[model samples]
Target: MNEVFAIADEVAVFRDGAYIGLQRADSMDGDSLISMMVGRELTQLFPERDKPVGKLLMSVRDLALDGVFEGVSFDLH
Candidate 1:
């Protein structure tokens, strides 16, 4: 996880209640960590986007909710 990498100096992996390995957080990336945890190399973590993205369906500029939020802007397709 991002938090784990951010806060941990070293990372230890356990799979099926068995200790796998330990390595420096900076020495590993998410895919490597995941591969160790799952006991296999990850080919694709996410599916490829098949459909082409459509045009923007909505837009919000300078949106605010009083004291909750301010100057928010985004576009959605």
Candidate 2:
């Protein structure tokens, strides 16, 4: 997938046979790519009401990769 950033100047993401959006490789990241593919923010994609919270299921802390990935976090039950 990093090759995508190396060779392509732009990428057009899609869903269900429909065009989603056009974006530059330099501007893309794991979070943004997931949002485009899922059609919503990872947080908003799954609401608390969909599942009970406050159980301390799983957590990601201080994840970073210099300029590539930074302060990214998530949780799941």
Candidate 3:
């Protein structure tokens, strides 16, 4: 994304083969790009959950996959 902005003079955004809009590379951000592509404002892109997020939903500690990777870890809360 950074590389695209640095090298491209202009950007043409599209959605489902429909032309959304064209923008200068220097004048765009993630939110604006998403909004343009989806035809919705950033605020409306994600739904608001009624329940608040609570404590640790899941946790992965020192997970390793043989022959592929090792020592991977993460947590979802």
Worst 10 residues of 1 by lDDT: 40-49
Per-residue CA lDDT of model 1 for 1-77, tens digit only, reads 99999999999999999999999999999999999999887876565789998999999999999989999999999
Question: Which candidate's lDDT is highest?
Answer: 1
lDDT (Cα atoms) of all candidates against the true structure: 0.93, 0.83, 0.86
| Model 2 stretches astray by more than 4 angstroms | 1-3, 44-77
Where does model 1 exceed 4 Å of error? 44-77
- TM accuracy, model 3: 0.62
lDDT of model 2 at position 15: 92
lDDT of 2 by residue, 1-77 (tens): 67777888888899999999999878897678778988889899766795546777889987899879898888865
All candidates: CA RMSD in angstroms? 4.9, 7.8, 3.5
Q: Is candidate 1 or candidate 2 better by TM-score?
A: 1
Clashing residue pairs, candidate 3?
A: none
Output the better candidate (2/3) by TM-score.
Answer: 3
Better of 1 and 3 by TM-score: 3
